[model samples]
Target chain A: MRAAMKDGARGASMTPRGIAAPVLGGWSAASEGVPANVRTISLQAVKIRMRSVGNIQKITKAMKMVAASRLKGAQTKCEKSRAMVNPFVRLLGDTPGAETEQTLVVPVSSDKGLCGGINTAVVKYSQVLNAMTPGVTYNVIGDKARAQLTRMMPQQINNVIVDTTKQPLTFATASAIADQVVARNAPKTHIVYNRFASAISFKPSVATLMSNEELEKAAEEGVNEFDSYEIEGPDRSEFLLDLSEFKAGVMMYNAMLENNTSELGSRMQSMENSSKNASEMLAKLTLLYNRTRQAAITTELIEIISGASSLESKE
Target chain B: MSRAMMRLARRVVGKNASVPVRGASTQSRASIETFMKNFEQHKTSPTMEHPATSSTFASTPVTEDVKGTPEKMKLNFYLPHDAPFDKTEVDMVLVPATTGDFGVLPGHVPTVSQLRPGVVSVHVSDKDVQRYFVSGGFCFVHADSTTDICAVEAVPVEQLDPEAVKKGLAEHQAKFANAKDDVEKAHAQIGIDCCNAMVSAIEGK
Candidate 1:
């Protein structure tokens, strides 16, 4: 992914000549510093590599902190909003599943990488769902999912929305996505997302948002419960259709929130691990540096002693 | 005069934050009608004051146990950007539903109402009424006396300027008259409708 990102940036910028000069300048400076003995050069390379890794560790640590804070807010928001849909979820539960052959899959993932397995899980789940359903179309959100799914299930992907995981996912974003899904006119809509299980664990889960006909079928199955509330004015069919559309958008919003929380949680965990690895690598490199410096000093002393003995023999 | 109108028309197109789609406008129309009917159903009931205690929210499964009538309705209002109101209990809430205006009390029936661009008047008490301008969303009234209103964007009513609303209305009207295509005309129409509603809300109509 990093390689792809670098390539993408290079293509977009198209300023390789400007970037190459500074890079070559640094390389020349490094070469000028040493006589370039094989062992010394290897040691210098390790030091430079260690410094870069240390810098990366610092960046990951900061990213982890940011993700951790955002996860707290996203988790709470997702939980509260999920509560708001409880009654509707129950009402739909009684509704019979739609008999539609075609299904629309909404895979929720974030744009940023260094988050381990967040996008992969969503893509893998869609693959499973695609296999289960005969004809499946995908409406993918976020760049990460777009990249992965385009490779995994190229034929199924219909639309790809990038950069939706921008800071603060809002209701308008979800509504726009819902509009796109509605436009597709698929009878069964399934949202594949990562459910935030805990700070350390998350599992990809699927929620099915039923079509208008399916809701009516469910309402009929649970008539006693449905009749308890007085529906005011709109025709039953129209009301059901509108309700399904609205709830589907809200459901998508909730799924995005949950997926965001999981993404952050996974990012924080992965970053923490990477930072630890970096420090460990730094320690090992430092030890090698000490050992190599000592060996160089001892070799110089031996050469000096041998030169003095040859001089005494000549005298 | 036509030149001035044209200038205003250009400004209006730029000023309109979100261009409403044909489907949303039609859907809100249906919801407004239903909302009006709901308002009529509850109009005869006298307003009652209840003790105000805000509610906390969780994603727990809905309990099947029969719930006793509560004194006030618990509201959990969420906006996509940030929550304007979250799990706050209130005595009554008058929402501008897509169909019509209606109020929710502690024991209102379980129904779903889509929203249009209008004010959500939340009655926290007899004297404390908090109003918010909601840019289209949904209100779900649960059997457990919980009412949740979710929207794309919401701002406090006090924050809205009547002068701006008037200007917007004029500009949108000019655009509507001069629009060349059906799509452009429809966009201007949504702008007009929203601005008109904003004026009415600010005037306490």
Candidate 2:
């Protein structure tokens, strides 16, 4: 019943569009036959296009302002939360994970669109990583990434966590996602995200989160970074377990925040470019409008002069 | 003969000036031992000059001029929205750990401990100290004499309103009584606990 009601409402609202459809169709159809009538209708068309473009420019400019303000708040949150992850980074310094049979790629992104390929960058990077590595599965947060990854690699996706940006992103939200990654129990987990470089720039980056078992294996493989970090507690094994869990959570939180900040930054920059392009289009259209109006006036003057001369000649 | 005995005693506590126990129980430092001894003696004495100064001794850090003990710890207190204590240098910081309140001086051993809801006092000097009521986070004392407290939320002790805490505590109890589900009960219980902790923290002053 509700669906029918919605359809009825939409059908009721479609009258204006239905009425407009044939007039536009007829105008385009007539334009093809009567080439000489271009100048007369084009002025009205140019004016309409200019008005629409002007409205678009206004909307983009407003979006840019909103994004700029949100970017400031996001940057501060990103900076404040950076403190907890410093020690973790020092422990697990930005190194790619050891090659394992099974790996999990968790792509972090924001849900909203018009963010200048931040999500695309993450999806592309994850795809490349998945291709290069063997036995890789995907667990994605944010609907933006889920939709794109689902489209490209439907079989590879293991889990889809959506609405990550619906509320203010927090440690709890990140940890919930991180818990899903942990539950998969993949030997190697690589989190693909857009690292916030600056207000105008962001780079697609991968942060590796390892479980305690992987850490132990990595230690046997090479350098044991855990020994360097002095953990002064009784239960070393238990501490390692909790530390790794918290470690993954902290890393996830930081990565999610960085991705969020990058999304905002990308949105602002994209909107800025869009606003600029709109203004440029408006400038070009205005110039064309003026030139066409001048041409029409000049043609009218020439016709009047020629008619008067023919009259005088006849007289 | 005396240095060997000192070595034996030091081995019993910890290695290399690092106290295995909390800061309060470290009796190796003569300065700290004397500071506590004098306080005990003054508590029993009739002619105590300043009672207020002596009363708040547990929270306040008494810094003595010990050579090579720079005691200059940098505190980086972080909230999700702000970092008011970014690399702020202080003589000492008292972290409210899950175990208990422990003071972190310079050259302290590296340890990561979970924090409880309590006051973290950063002592700049004997006179100037800043206190924050941290709402449960992790406290990290690195080997580089930098202590970072990443609280879920923190506010200055002065900013907490006692009247609001009282009202909140009563409301939380009522909610706990009325809560039908386990999650709601747990939620109300958390609110009650936090408010109760705040009440004790305010009254403990």
Candidate 3:
């Protein structure tokens, strides 16, 4: 892939030479090793290359700034919301699981590219999940993951939610997605997303969202998990179901925020590295250009001195 | 009342900070452990007053079995998207449960009520009763008399304009009348029912 990309760039630079060579006899001169024009052409190409790389560095720097700011917002949100669901997290851990015939996999990814391996890691995790659990259907959020997953398991691609990352994450977004997942009425839903471990690290993890019937079935299995505290209210079963739905929304929203934070962090890290690489490449290119130009000048001077000496010898 | 709610929020935040997976402060964990111990002690004794806070520990002389001292319950009303009442204190709360419309008071039996789309009248103070139109959710009455209501969506009763409800009811009725299939009719009917409920809630009927 790298070689192909290099060739593509080389081909783009060669186009002007290819089109203008015959009219100007520039190709013939270059073939005969006329160092002046050759040096000029190479110098022009290197300068253009350096300028383009500098532009790319600027872009990556800007992206890093944007991602850094967005990551702060997402991190704050994740921190604020994590507390509300702590009890549920502990309860779900203690609860027994009942397997269903169908499983809905919600892959949380973002649409943007240049975020190194964020989408790829999620898609790969989903593939592993699909391999482990056959007959799993996919409800993809981001376009990048959807495209990859579609390629990997076309039959399982059930729905693809369009990109909404242009706007900040909101609970309404989560509810809209919850509505879709509920509409599908899948008993078992697994939200596969990148857990923001830190600014430098992320781990792809899965959280299960159970349907009302499944929760009822689990409740009937009677683990009696809420033994520590007494719960009072009528229609406990329906309340549990509603609580499950509400938790699902909260879970989805949390996942979205975490994934967004991870994406931003990844983008910021990758862009910082890329901008450094671009500048390094530019520095090397500039050094090479200067060396080649100096070499060309020396060759021209030697040619002139040798020509003068040969004329004096003939005299 | 708000102070108790703040303590609950502090506990939540403290717990979040103490989670080891995030590499948080172990100091916070010790504090949380103390809070949990206090919580467990309260749970085991089931007292009418909180021991830690002595300000509200005044003895209420109860003379009858049916009518106890009117104590207050911490009402934490949360929506999936936002918390309208983050562990606020209220004297009593009336909810329209699917089983039936019921009122919850201090020392009410531990129960979980599935709420319907209707008004939730919260008696915040002796003079102030805040009403909200809650779109279906759940209400949990804890053994310790702390009430938590999780609603899907809710708007303050005063925020629901009568003109908007009337317009929504008309549109839903038209959709219900013009529906070609049972599913569409059922969908429109739900809209109509919600709008009617909104109107009733706004009217304070």
Candidate 4:
């Protein structure tokens, strides 16, 4: 009876161990063993993924560097041009002359892509402007601008100008646009673009391009009666004309510079965010892997102890 | 007429008889002649003493003496950060215009001139001049005598490093000398020559 009881106890324990061993071992093997093939495949997949991420990082880094360099140049140009235009505008404001009947708004945007949402935001602002003032016509500068305007308010677009790819946004191009506007009898031309605020911030800005009438008014106001002795010949008139064009050109050039800087800043910020997200994902995956590995090791240790105790008791 | 003459002769003869002698009459006549000469001298002296004529001639010296003091002129000047002078008394802003050199002084006619890349001289009130090198752009002088210059690019000549300019010129020259094509060589040569000239001008050589 004693032998049978001992045997029954041993059998019960053995049965429990037997049942638990396979289950625990199987779990351990499945979790920890991760079959060499599966491990190889997973590691290969990780490596591929890591390689892709690295490539993305490289591209982003390159882009960031390029944007940084370009941003510096563009910012300088933008700032200098802004300084040039402000005085001219102030001159216009101070001039006591006849106001024009029409105001033309020239919206500058990029023909290309990768500088995200800047083109879209500029277009949206234009739409808002159009809504505020009915019958307002637009002179679009880039392909993206033309595309956005065409889809939303095709009728509002009076002229679509294709960019001179060689020059891009330049004084010459601005002059051409100004000339066209002047010829069309547009009284005042305003430029709309994204002004760079920071690496992640770009605010839309609008600047006025002085018209001939404004120039004339400035000249008239600038000419004092006491000093009328200084006003000579077609020289004053010629100066006024050149001043108007130069002011307009500078305005356009500055807008382009601001837009370029803002675009690069946006891209840099976006890339930095991407890099941060990638690192976060990598950390999560590594934690998951460690947990699965630890769980497998604990199961194997428990199984080994249980097996050792059961065999020793049977002996 | 004969009766009157006879009366005159009789009066003369009675007067002659009443006279003491010819010598006494001669003495009276000599005295009369002396009195006539004195009268002529008094008339000329009185004319010379007239206050209106003499005062007009004497007033010219006072008027001429008052105008001898020189009038002084004042001018105000503002210099850029890169410029040598912090502040100067400027009489005018002289810019190198594309058409020609132009000047802006107080009470100048309102004008606008296209500026080219060159040196700008600012004439000061003290007759001293400050010079700046400006790049291409335009300048506007208001009737209020406020002159505003919009330069496409501007840098003080002093700010440019002479050594760097020389090095750049040499490099550009070498590049041109070794160019495989005429077009490339021409472009490089132009750049080299420009740098060379700029360096020389800035160094005052």
The model with the greatest TM-score is 1
lDDT (tens digit, per residue) of candidate 1 on A1-315: 356334333333433244334434544565577444544554575566556656766776888899898888888877755653443554444211234678898888888888888788787666656655669899998898898888877988999887877657676678788888878878778787887878888766666677787667656755324444555447667777877787777778878888888898999998788767667766766776676677767867997999999999999
Residue pair clashes in candidate 4: A230-B109
Clashes of each: 7, 0, 6, 1
Over the stretch B1-205, how does candidate 4's per-residue lDDT look in tens digits?
A: 5998778756654543342212112222333234223322343222111111001111111011223322321222222112233223357677777677776666555565677557777676556666666655666555445556666545667777788888888889889889999999998976775575467559762
Q: Write model 3 residue lDDT over B154-178, tens digit each, in one string.
A: 8888888899889999999999999
CA lDDT of each candidate?
Answer: 0.68, 0.69, 0.67, 0.55
> Could you tell me which 10 consecutive residues in candidate 4 chain A have the lowest summed lDDT?
A223-232
lDDT of 3 at A187: 83
What's the lDDT of the predicted structure labeled candidate 2?
Answer: 0.69
Off by over 4 Å in 2: A1-39, A91-95, A216-234, B1-69, B167-196
**DockQ of all models, two decimals each:** 0.06, 0.07, 0.07, 0.03
Q: Please estimate how well model 1 matches the true structure, expressed as its whole-model Cα lDDT.
A: 0.68
Over 4 Å off, model 3: A1-36, A65-102, A128-137, A151-176, A183-186, A197-203, A224-247, A294-315, B1-74, B87-91, B121-130
Identify the leading candidate in terms of DockQ. 3
Q: Which scores better on DockQ, 1 or 4?
A: 1
Ranking by TM-score: 1, 2, 3, 4
Interface RMSD, candidate 3? 14.9
Ranking by lDDT: 2, 1, 3, 4
Better of 2 and 4 by DockQ: 2
